[model samples]
Each structure stands twice: as C-alpha cells, then as structure tokens.
Target: MSQFAENVSKRLCSLDVFRGMTMFLLIAEAAGFHEHFSTVTEGTVFSGIALQLHHHPWNGLRFWDLIQPFFMFIVGVAMPFSLRKRLAAGNQKKVTLHILRRCALLFCFGGLIALCL
Candidate 1:
C-alpha cells in the first residue's frame, strides 16, 4: 500500500506471455510444420491448427499474418508504460521530445531494414 510498490507494479514488462506465444506460433508456422502435418491427418489438434495456421493457400491473411500485428501491438502496449514511467520520474518536460526522437529513430531503423531487402 505504498507509492513505491505502485510504481514498481507500473513498470513496463517487455516479456509479455502473449508476445512470446505469438512469436512462438509465428516461428513454428514459418518452420513448414504445417506442410509436414498436412500430409498425415485430416482431423486433429496439430493438423487443424496447421490447416488454419497458414495464409489462404498463397495470398491473403490468417492467424499466420497476424504475427507482425501482434508484435506491433506489443510495441503499442509498451509505449504507454514506458511514457508513464518517464513522465512520473520528473521527465515530463522532455517526454514529448524523447518520444518524437525515438519514433523518428524507429522509422529510420525500419527504413534501413527495408533497404536491406
């Protein structure tokens, strides 16, 4: 029942279980497990998941395409927590400055990564 405990609880937790689960599902789906299992059964947990795990044959979205969205969602979730912490620690005046700088940096980083492709 203290301010310190409240602050501690408000800390940004980057290791979210949902994020980890999404990453795991993405990696496993991208590993060709779906194709491997598709040859074996028509009905089963692994098979059904594998069947629904893929994009619609060749082009379109599914649970498979949601992996990137999940990552973006986690980033969005972290932002509020991160900003709250920074602002709470008497960094209010610079919060906007820092967020803008970081967003610009992230944009440039994305561009650089895209250029590599």
Candidate 2:
C-alpha cells in the first residue's frame, strides 16, 4: 500500500473507532432499544439509562442529542489527516476540488434528508 495510505490508517484508528461507536449508538436508538428498555425496566437504573439514551422532548439536551455532534466531531477530527494524506499522495488541485465538491454534496444531501424526515 501507499505510504500516505499507511500513515492515515495508522493515525486514524482511534478516530475511526470513535466514529464507529457513535454510529452504533445511533443505530441502536433507531432500533428502539431505548424505548424497549424504558418500557421493560421502568423505575429502575436501566430505565434511567434508557431515558438518557433518548433525545429530550424539547428545549433541552440529552446524551442522545450529542450523537450527531459527536459524529460531526469525529469527521472534523479526521478531515485534516485525510486531506494531508491526499496531498502527500500527490493528488492534483482538481482532485482537491472534487473532494470539496463531494463534501458539499454530502452536506446538502444530509440536510435534505433531515428535512424529509
């Protein structure tokens, strides 16, 4: 493998793990694990954890509310390493432009999907 690729891979292990755990939590939320726990273990410590696992009803924040921000933070943490790796691999200006455009597209698509939801 390329040196740049190797360097990025080595540098990003922790970031990748963080990102994966955030995604897993998001998926668990989607699967209604929190709701299930709340129903099954009401008034118990597990239920308390279940409550924290869900988003606040309104005008407040919960641990679940941090999932998106945590995901974004992970992305932000990796961006510099990724860009440096690409540059070190001798990618051209056009390739950098393409990467920027793709990032914009992803942001737009995410916003659109959120709106639809």
Candidate 3:
C-alpha cells in the first residue's frame, strides 16, 4: 500500500468507511438527489430510508439514530491518537490538561444545543 494509505489504515479502518457511507446515503441520496437512486434501489432500501432512520414518534431505536453514536465513537477513538502524538512531541502536560478542558467544552456545547432545541 502507499504510504498515505498505510498511515490512514493505522489510524482508522472499515468502520470509518461505514460511517462515510451512512453519511453519504443520508446527505447525498436522501436530502438531495434521491430520484437518481430510486430506480436502482430495491423496494426495502432507500425508500424513505432517511425518514425511518430518524427517531420514532415517542421513543425507540433506529438505524438512523445510530449516526450520532457513530460520530461520538470516532471522536472518542481520536482522543488516544491525538494524546499519543502530543506526548511523543513532549507535550504531555498540555495533553493532560486539554483532555478535561475538551470534555467540559463538549459537554457545555451539547447542553447549550439541547437547551436551544
């Protein structure tokens, strides 16, 4: 494999591909040009797939609902890689401090967004 491909594989694997595919299907096909895939997709697929991915009326799980979880998982996965790089570069102090700061910031941001909603 090429150096770039090898480096990326060391970072994340096919799970990232799945996330990208999910995002592409939701954004490109569902939100934008769904008509293009209508003829090619089977009856059970892509037919209101976007709508179904969203949460149910009151409460329940759904494939579309997992998108947020997948994104949060990627961020969690990134923390170790990012912290390791900082430590390797002699920034262990900064890395240690930033982890908590980032967590707090993310929590606050999420809270604010939820409040607005």
Error of 2 at 77 (Å): 0.3
Better-scoring candidate (lDDT), 2 or 3? 2
Error of 1 at 117 (Å): 2.7
The candidate 2 region of ten consecutive residues with least summed lDDT is 4-13
**How well does each candidate superpose onto the true structure, as a TM-score?**
0.63, 0.75, 0.57
After superposition, which runs of candidate 1 have C-alpha atoms over 4 Å from their true positions?
1-15, 30-46, 56-61
Model 3 misplacement above 4 A: 1-10, 13-15, 29-55, 58-61
Q: Return model 1's CA RMSD, one decimal.
A: 4.1
- Counting only residues 3 or more apart in sequence or on different chains, how many pairs clash (N, Cα, C under 3 Å) in candidate 2? 0
Error of 1 at 45 (Å): 6.4
Model 3 lDDT per residue over 1-117, tens place = 587786664556665786687678568645645555444454755666645544456466766577678888867777677678778877767777887898899999999999999
How many residue pairs clash in each candidate at the backbone level? Answer: 0, 0, 0
- Predicted model with the maximum TM-score: 2
**TM-score between candidate 3 and the true structure:** 0.57
Candidate 2 at residue 69, lDDT? 88
> Which has the better lDDT: candidate 1, or candidate 3?
1
Local distance difference test scores for all models = 0.75, 0.82, 0.69
Tell me the lDDT of model 2 at 85.
78
